[model samples]
Target: MSTTQTQMRREIEEIPTAVDRLLSTSAGAIETAISKIGNDVPFLMSVARGSSDHACAFLKYACELELGLPMASVGPSVASIYGAKLRVPNAVCISVSQSGKSPDIVELTRAITEGGATSVAITNDATSPLANTATATLPICAGPELSVAATKTFVTSLVAGLWLLAEFKQDQELVKAIRALPEHLEKAIACDWTVAANAITGQSVLTLGRGPSFAISNEAALKFKETCQIHAESYSSAEVMHGPVSIVERGFPVIGFAASDAAEDSLIEVADALTEKGALAFVTSKKAKKAICLPHQRTDHWLTDPISTIVSFYTMVEKVSTARNINPDAPRHLNKVTETV
Candidate 1:
């Protein structure tokens, strides 16, 4: 095996610094974005595709649980392709894009802003079209990422969006946790997921999560496919028991992402159930009965703990890619920026 570190690994290791940079440099921008939302905002709208969309999903849960506002994702094609007009005068739209250059995202953000919604662009490039189109721009400050599989950018985007929500709600506890994330994420990057890495022996795998962790699960599934050429599927713990369990077989790999939240016990239960069915199940929580517990990093707050899990996941997936003799820095057909319209 080659001892050379891939760009993906370097980017994954830089996640903590990226988040720290975002928190330190983007505070003023985050505050400015919050001011634009105003107090009487009715709801929230999200716009993005791929990993950026997963970040929006994570923010969707945060907005509902923290701000008590409903967040729905508005498809970019509605404006880019169909030329449909949106009327969200009282809503606040958050568009997440690492490059902030996607034509579809830029077009939809423009439409929503023209329709009377206050638009906020969360991106690394403040000069990109999406940032120029939105009412406010909160740059992620993840620096330049050369890897096709995003690591630092994704984590920074999560921090940027969560920080915006935390500041908007003025929740000091969550804000403190956000501020302390750099160190926690440093530990998260060192978490040993060797068991999970060894579990990927076949072409297919299953991942489970609930609540905010489900968004991380979605990102994990995407990474497995893009980086390791594995057919991975993610499901909510509640939904997996219904029909997805039919595919579980003996010695099958199942990874469950459970943060220290209300849904942790329920998610672990599903991991244990899958373990009982003879699958090699691994969960992040220690309360699992039959499932194996992977070493995980937990933050001071439940909301931020799931974000740490994704950092650990990035490390493990990078190793999986190298062990399979694939170059994670460059996936077969992916680019650094996808400007879809």
Candidate 2:
């Protein structure tokens, strides 16, 4: 590996500082959104795509696990294409867009807001249309992300969304964890995932996780595709054994993302089980008996653990891209801002 770094690597390294910036600067916006939400919400909805969508998925787990409130992702096309006005009265809708320029996201957010949901837009661009259309806007504060494959923006988005949820629930524990993430993420960035990277020499790989970490698995798979040009699939550990395990062959690369949560043991068992099937499986948890255990930085809380895991994965993915001689900064056929209609 060259001593030089790519834009993706720089962004990956910036995640810790970006999160610290967000926690310091975004408090007012988050407080305003929480005030609008006001605790009696029956359920929550999310609007996003790509990495932002995966961030929302992680927040969905956070919302459900932390606040005991159900959350779902509302397809932007519902309002953008079909122009359907769905009933979401007295609900909270969170729309995440790093660029905040996508027409579908803006249109759907506007429609959802008009449909009686207290909408909050999380974006890097505080002045964009989605920001203006939503009830409140929370800038991710990740600064300028030059890489086409999002790194800092994704981490900051996850932090922004989780921070909002934590404040809304008045969960001081989670809030403390959120505030402590910058330090933990610094450690996460230092974690060497070269073993997992080297195992990913094949065209296809499987990523497994459960609950919140499943969202990280999804984002990791997307990053592999975008940065390394590899075919990666993410599956919930519970769902993988149903049929997806049929594809596991000798030396198949499998990575399981496990956090210090209720789902950790089960995910570890699944990772080890895959190893029994002749797959070269790796997991983050040290409890893994058969699967290779990768060094991972655990955060102050379970919810924050997955966030750290992604930072480590980002570093590893950058190494994988470097090994393949692929320019992760400008992925083929991709642009910084994807304006969807």
Clashing pairs counted in every model: 0, 0
**Shift of residue 277 alpha carbon in model 1, Å:** 0.7
Residue 198 in model 1: lDDT: 91
Q: Which parts of model 2 are misplaced by more than 4 Å?
A: 1-3
Error of 2 at 298 (Å): 0.2
Weakest ten-residue segment in model 2 by summed lDDT: 31-40
- The whole-model lDDT of each prediction reads 0.93, 0.94
lDDT of 1: 0.93
Q: What TM-score would every model get versus the actual structure? A: 0.99, 0.98
Q: Write the per-residue lDDT of candidate 1 for residues 1-341, one digit (tens) a residue.
A: 68899999998888998888888888899888888887899999999999999999999999999999999999999999999999999799999999999999999999999999999999889999899999999999999999999888888888898999998988999999999999999999999999889989999999889999999999999999999999999999999989989998999999999999999999998899999988999999999999999999999999999899999999999999999999999889888888898
Model 2 C-alpha lDDT per residue in residues 1-341, reported as the tens digit of each score:
56688988888888999999999998999888888885579999999999999999999999999889999999989999999987889999999999999999999999998998999999999999999999999999898999999999999999999999888878999999999999999999999999999999989999999999999999999999998899999999999999999999999999999999999999999999999999999999999999999999999999999999999999999999989989999989999999999
Candidate 2, residue 179: the lDDT equals 98
